[model samples]
Target: MPTEPYRIAYYTDEQGNKPFREWLQGLRDQIAAVRIRARLTRVKAGNFGPVRNVGEGVVELKIDHGPGYRVYYAIDAGTIILLLCGGHKRTQQRDVEIAQRFWKNHQEQRK
Candidate 1:
């Protein structure tokens, strides 16, 4: 079980505007089922980078939904925060690097 609650976050992109919303709604429901089965609680939010550090009680999890979609999240304090959700590929190191840099900037901003 998680020691703290979880929070969710969203990433905004042209591809995610409307379709992502609907997709996320379904994903949320799936997550709820996962939570119940896993015996944990989950929450969702937006702004991926900031919450990574802000929600100290959470842990991050990434999911590859499909060819052009990846989901990032943090689970802590008994809650799960959805950090990023968009289309890309594992082979695209650049995208990962960008996200890392963004997250790093977020860390610096806190100080």
Candidate 2:
């Protein structure tokens, strides 16, 4: 059977503001290399929604040199969709609420 497609996404915070774009680019490159090795294609899914849980395949990975910034991602089928990336870990509740609002607004705009 054919495999499903997987994608990637990224988010950044104030601490990562200056290098967030570059960091994201590097991430894309790394993932691209992995895809090539595994013989798969991955797409980028920028800021889809709030990152609620973090586990084995659904956890936030810290970006080197990026204090307070966590990169949340998920792997599904053959794709890795980056869900959220930002700081403000101290305000988890507020951050989630704000992210939800942003997601809602974005969805509405897509209609």
TM of each candidate vs. truth: 0.38, 0.35
lDDT of 2: 0.41
Question: How do the residues 1-111 of candidate 2 rate in per-residue lDDT, one tens digit apiece?
Answer: 755444544333435442223434455346443432232122242333333464334444333332344544444344555354333346545445544443443345446
> What digit string (tens of lDDT, one per residue) describes model 1 on residues 26-109?
654465435322322233332233222323322333342344334333332344343432223554354444445444444454
**Candidate 2: stretches off by over 4 Å:** 1-4, 9-51, 54-68, 71-85
- The top-ranked prediction according to TM-score is 1
- Number of the top candidate by lDDT? 2
Q: Candidate 2 — number of clashing residue pairs? A: 7
Clashes of each: 25, 7
What are the lDDT scores of the predictions, listed in order?
Answer: 0.38, 0.41
RMSD for each of the candidates: 9.1, 9.3
- The stretch of ten residues in a row with the least summed lDDT in candidate 1 is 50-59
Error of 2 at 100 (Å): 0.5
